[model samples]
Target: MPAMTEPKLISGNSNRPLAQQIARRMSLHRGMSVSLVDARVERFNDQEVFVEVYENVRGEDMFIVQSTSNPANDNLMELLIIADALKRSSASRITAVIPYFGYARQDRRTKARTPISAKLVANMITQAGIDRVLTLDLHATQIQGFFDMPVDNLYAAPVFALDVQHHFKGRLQDVTVVSPDVGGVARARELAKRIGCALAIVDKRREKPGEVAEMTVIGEVTGKTCIIVDDICDTAGTLCKAASVLMDAGATEVHSYITHGVLSAPAVERITKSVMKSLVITDSIQPTEAVKAAPNIRVVPTAPMFAQAILNTWSGTSVSSLFDVDTLTPIYEGLYHRG
Candidate 1:
């Protein structure tokens, strides 16, 4: 068997800091040092995407780290162009490490003449010569079916669980995991189960996209520390509203652990002004200046987890073990299951 070539990472402009952090974490995992590919991903005069890989990637495994975040189209285009460049350079394998998958919320058609944008985006990635995908906490788990190639959808539960354990410590029994709406009950239940806490759901009636008609708490949260678990925080309208409803339901305070902080306009402002004690999110989407300046919002680094996932993928190891609480290390320990 031929010796496996070291994997080369190529990052688009979407989240260079995260890409660099992942690269550094990977280097620490093993004796062999993994480095980023010398690539220049820039725009032309008319705002068109361009890519150039300076190093020889012939037969080398390549991974592109790019999040389809704020400028979704531009970043997504950069990823495709980079993949095409790598394919032309004879790269043996190309995997897309998309931390935040945009258009994921549009996985299904809600009305007539509506497009399933998530499926369309999956097709675009597959057609770009990419062989596999590694993404964190997709908005809709079913979106994995849209991809023709191998797709690894990792959960942020381990990271969030660890943080919860650390923050809640001796008061773990007083913490209650909450789902902002019915659609997220499963996600909330999993976290609550992992943390050995009571589970609750916010029965929210949304009349429109950004409006909540009514909300009612489904479980006992009186005097409990409520923690809402969600995948993305876009406008934060749902989160802020949920927090208010939870507080009104007699919860002492509310916190949130979201996988992606796609904090669009007024999200930070809403979170800052809301009664929620804190809003914790992963560094899946690059944080803007306002998010950084917000007092109630905190970001957890996904680099360590993503780095381990990438290493496991490269070694043909079981990536799912990373989520097994029993197998996790001290820094990322498993959540306790109280009877």
Candidate 2:
């Protein structure tokens, strides 16, 4: 491959710190020179998004790293505008690296008149001329099908599962992996299987947005340390409430491992006072000061993992092995879960 084909990563305001870190990690890991593209993302007096890519990206494989987080609409628009700018600049291939894919929870219609916003967002990106996409821990994995182009839905399971092993001192049997909601059973089941432990589900009923009516513990967790797992913790309502329910169900203690710490208003305060022992989340989205200040909330750097994926993509190698759940399970099973 020609040196000119090397990736040029750029950042948006949503999570520039993480994008910069991923670029540095990639260069260090592969011994290749990598730097973010020189660009300016600004807003006009009327709050309209504007993007300007200073460097010539003609024929370069461009990757724009942006997390459509907090200011979801604004950040999202910036991504689209930047992709358009890169396309106009003659970028060979444009990949939008969204660490946190917004509107993913609305992938399916619940109410009669509801729209599949996830698919709509997917359409917008493709329409903006994005050649591909790279994102982490989408709220719904099936949303990958929404895109016509290649969509790499990376997982945080390997990171969370390995941390669970270390957190429990390699004693897998004593741990119980839990799903905070029935919808998350698949995710919890994967982690539980990796640890070779039992699985439990928290039965929660949602009355409306941001409101969980009731929660019940579904399986045995009485004598074990329960780790509640989920994808995104926007309001943390589900996590905090489920932790309380688990503790009340005779569990010794509770902890949580979530992918994106959206940590919207009151999320940090609720998490800090919750019954969970600790809450570990990946730095997919740049954590807020409140998230950093919360004692129980811990942020894990995902730059190393993303760095590996970026290198694999640039080298024309398959990036699937980076976080393949099944491949990682047997290793832990042999190490400590053996009878």
Candidate 3:
């Protein structure tokens, strides 16, 4: 196996703090040698997008850190331009490290006329000259197959599991893991198995994008402390509604654990008024000011995990075991259920 060279970290305008955190984990600051030129990215009078990258990236193993979160178009364009710049400047390799990959929910088309936006995004990235991709908790695991190049889908479950263990040490006997919807059963099941707790599912009906009606619980949540788990919490509609349902089902307390916090449009207020005790989210997407100010929202940093993955990848070691569920099962089981 070839030893990986020191990677050059570059940041677009998407999430500077996260890029800084990842750099800190790697024990290196952002490279000062390459200049990141901020070009005015706006549509013409007719409303068309344009981009430019003013930096040189010749012969560098460049990594562009950008999260396609809110204001997805602008951030996506910035990433594409930066990758193009690196490719044109003859960079040895360009890796796109996207903590939050937007449009991931569209991995497959539900309706006949709808497009597979996730595949489209993959095409765009590949065409933009990105040699590889590293993203966290993609909505659909199969989205990775959409890409032609190597894709590393890192898990935030270990981070969440560790935090859960730390917070509820001896009181895990009454805990129950929950999936906010049927689509997320796999994720919640993994967490439940790790924590050694019984699992529950929330069956919901979506009226529209930001509207949800939680119907019922699939498993035993009655009298149990419920932790609703999901990949992304955008409007907080599904989470809040599911929590309400759980509480009405005699759940002692309702909490939420989500991977990406894309808390958009009135989500803060919704969570504030909801019955949830707290909503724990990873720092995949940079939290908005509203999210930062929300009292019920708490953030868990993924710096250590990302750092470990980067080191392992660079060292030609297997990163698959970083958070093996089987290895951590005993720890989580003891913390959550076994006492």
lDDT of 2 by residue, 86-172 (tens): 999999999898999999989999889989999999999999999999999889888999999999988888878767776686566
What is residue 285's positional error in candidate 1, in angstroms? 0.5
Candidates' C-alpha lDDT:
0.90, 0.86, 0.80
Best by TM-score: 1
Q: Candidate 3: worst 10 consecutive residues by lDDT?
A: 28-37
Number of clashing residue pairs in every model?
0, 0, 0
Give the backbone clash total of model 1: 0
lDDT tens digits by residue: candidate 1, 298-330: 998888788888878887888888786554544
Where is model 3 more than 4 Å wrong at Cα? 1-4, 28-56, 325-339
Over 4 Å off in model 1, which ranges? 1-3, 330-339
lDDT of model 1 at residue 243?
A: 96
- TM, every model: 0.96, 0.93, 0.88
- Report lDDT (Cα) of residue 18, candidate 3: 80
Shift of residue 201 alpha carbon in model 2, Å: 0.5
Of 1 and 3, which scores higher on TM-score? 1
lDDT measured at residue 314 in model 3 versus the true structure, 0 to 100: 58
